[model samples]
Target: MSDSLERDALKEILTASIKEQRAARRWGIFFKVLTFGYLGLVMALMLGWIGAHESESASSGPHVGVVDLSGPIAADGDASSQLVIAGLKAAFEDKNTKAVILRANSPGGSPVQSGMMYDEIKRLKAKHSNTPFYVVVEDVCASGCYYAAVAGEKIFADKASIVGSIGVLMDGFGFTGAMDKLGVERRLITAGANKGFLDPFSPQSEEQKQKATAMLQEVHQQFINVVKEGRGKRLAADNPDLFSGLVWSGESGLKLGLVDALGSVDSVARDVVKVDNIVDFTPQPSYADRLARQLGVAAATTLGAKLEWQLR
Candidate 1:
């Protein structure tokens, strides 16, 4: 009886030990799975693969939609006209969006890109006539940026914000003198006489220079006309330096009628739009898109591509 009882106790102990081991293994697996799941979630969030749709969603009630136009306006840049227009289109389409705000902070870039955005803004504004569109300048809004900003119903800027560079420029380096010094002859053979117009490696011709100047003047006049049409009687018509490719402080810009008033996105949303809920409708480019754009820009730079016309 003693031996049997001893055997029974041993069996009980082994069974209990086995149960404990099984429980521990199960807990270990649960924890391992949880750890892996948490890591994957973090990676997804960091990679911008998740949570983008949530942020891009507009509020159900009345809110001000904001589209940021920062950096140089270029085809390959984040602040490109295509991205800006996409944001604007989304903002206008949203029923909850009471007013649209363009938060601009750009030095300037391509005239064509800027012009395209400007035209789109006008079209959107006309379509959404009830919804007011405004441009709130941050830090600086000059040249191409101003070109687009004028489409807004009103433009606001800080007291110290830089504003206004209404001009067009085409700049390039002449390598003719440098080639002479380096004992390198430019063997450029063009089918047409004006095909090599303003070629950096060749000596600049007076006729080509005149043609280029005339082109620049034409673009500059277009920029000036846009500002006039946008600002209207608010502009100080007597100010000679207004369109002389000069930048001015926001306070001065107000005096010169470049900006309508002094305000920010928050203030404008709250006071002007009568709603403080600012929903950002800026088109967030994916990681792959950004990488591809960078590659393209780098390739262009490597090929020594020059902008034919710029607002800067």
Candidate 2:
């Protein structure tokens, strides 16, 4: 009889535990629903606020073209030529826009990408001769970045900012010795004799070295020509090493005639542009987009947890 009573007690405990788990699960579902609902409401409110702000600003005053050239200036990067050109076009089309500002923060990337943007900026400026375009360098603007900057009517920078790395670079690794040591076979074929000149797995020939040097020299000359065209009479021709892939601080850059003035974005906007109010024309990711991204991450985490739980 005592054993029977113990079994009944054990069964009752198990049943009560199951009930508790069920209740907990219900609460969990409720909390998740509430959390998602709250996020949705917040997103709606943010969108409303942004729309209202845009409307109010549009009604109030003239717009300024503000294009953010952040990150490496590559065709594949966020600071792509297409995106920058689109922003510039939008600014140009805006009847209330007085001037265009290229806010640059980049170390640099593809020379081709930078050249494309520079040409576009110059063409646009020429097309809209009445509108002035200014460049404000932030943090670091070097190499291809400075190339684009010279397209601006005036260039401004912070005193300590890094500017000017006026040169081109092609990086590669040679692993012929390492591959030989490891008994690895390199299987590479090219149509042209000099096509694989910079191949790492193969031994470099004297002819290849000469060819590569000549190619780099040609590219360097092109870079120097672009700089000359952009800077015009401002750049001192005395410094032979100006285009030798060297960087300089904002102070030295100013002395070298790389930058026009030393000032922060706020100072330029308030003092130089002579407008107290400013509108950011740079496309910012919306809050809803950010929230959706966060939610996607959270969902992925939850899915991963579920998979782990199932595996366990």
Candidate 3:
């Protein structure tokens, strides 16, 4: 009887131990999964997943709706025309919005993107005539950025801010000399005569150069015309280089009529918009968008190698 009792006690203890181990494992897995989820949420919030939702305000009182136009303006870039247009639409459509402020700080990029944004802003203004639009420049607003800024009713900038670079450029490099030193021969094949016109690995052609220059000049002329139409009589006709792809300080720009006044976002929001409260309406890129863009870049980089042979 004693031996049987001892055997039963041992069996019960073993079963309880097994049960405890399974419970411990379950809790451990649950906590680890919870930790990983928390980390992912924090990372997403830091990367602007949450900020995108806060772009517009649910205000009932009059306030200035601000939209940031920072960094290079391009179709694939953060300052894309689509994002800007969406933000502008929201700001204009907001019932409590007194005025819209375009706060720009960039060295400019992609004339096509700038032109699209400029046209869209004009369309929005025409549709919403009551909501006044003003541009406030910080640091630099040159080339394409200036093109978009002029669409505003008035442009304000700090005294030391750099503004204006009304021009177009197509830049590249020639590696023929280096290739010759490295004993590399380029074997370029093309079906069309002008298909390889600007290939840097080949010899430069006088006719091609002339054609490229003319094309650039035409683009530059278009930029000049846009500035002229936007600034109108406010531009200083005395400065010959006003549209010569030259930049100037904000204070000098005021004298040269590149800028209307010297002020900042706060000042413009308060004095021009007649509201001290400024709500940002810049469209924030979500984490998924950012991830997709990164994936696109990776794919492009892989394809870039395949196109390396076209350099010839």
Q: How close is every model to the real structure, measured as TM-score?
A: 0.81, 0.73, 0.89
lDDT at position 196, candidate 3: 82
Q: Which predicted model would earn the best TM-score?
A: 3
Which 10 consecutive positions of candidate 2 have the poorest summed lDDT?
Answer: 303-312
lDDT of each: 0.86, 0.74, 0.82
Give residue 282's error in model 2 in angstroms: 1.6
For candidate 3, give the lDDT.
0.82
Give a tens-digit lDDT track for model 1, residues 36-97.
Answer: 99999887765668765433465467889999999988888988888899989999999889
lDDT of 2 by residue, 81-192 (tens): 7767877777766677777889999888767778889899989999999888899998988887888889988889988988887776555567889999999998988898
Off-target runs (Cα >4 Å) in candidate 3 are 32-51, 293-312
Tens digit per residue, CA lDDT, model 3, 1-312? 999999999999999999999999999999999999999889878677564566545554778888889887766667878778888898888999889989999888777778898899999999999999999999998888999899999999999998988777766677889999999998989898887877888877899879878977887887888888889999999887887778899999999888999999999987777789888888887777766665674322211111110000
Q: Candidate 3 at 134: error in angstroms?
A: 0.6
- Residue pairs clashing in model 3 are none
Q: Sort by lDDT, best first.
A: 1, 3, 2
User: Candidate 1, which ten residues in sequence have the lowest lDDT sum?
Assistant: 299-308
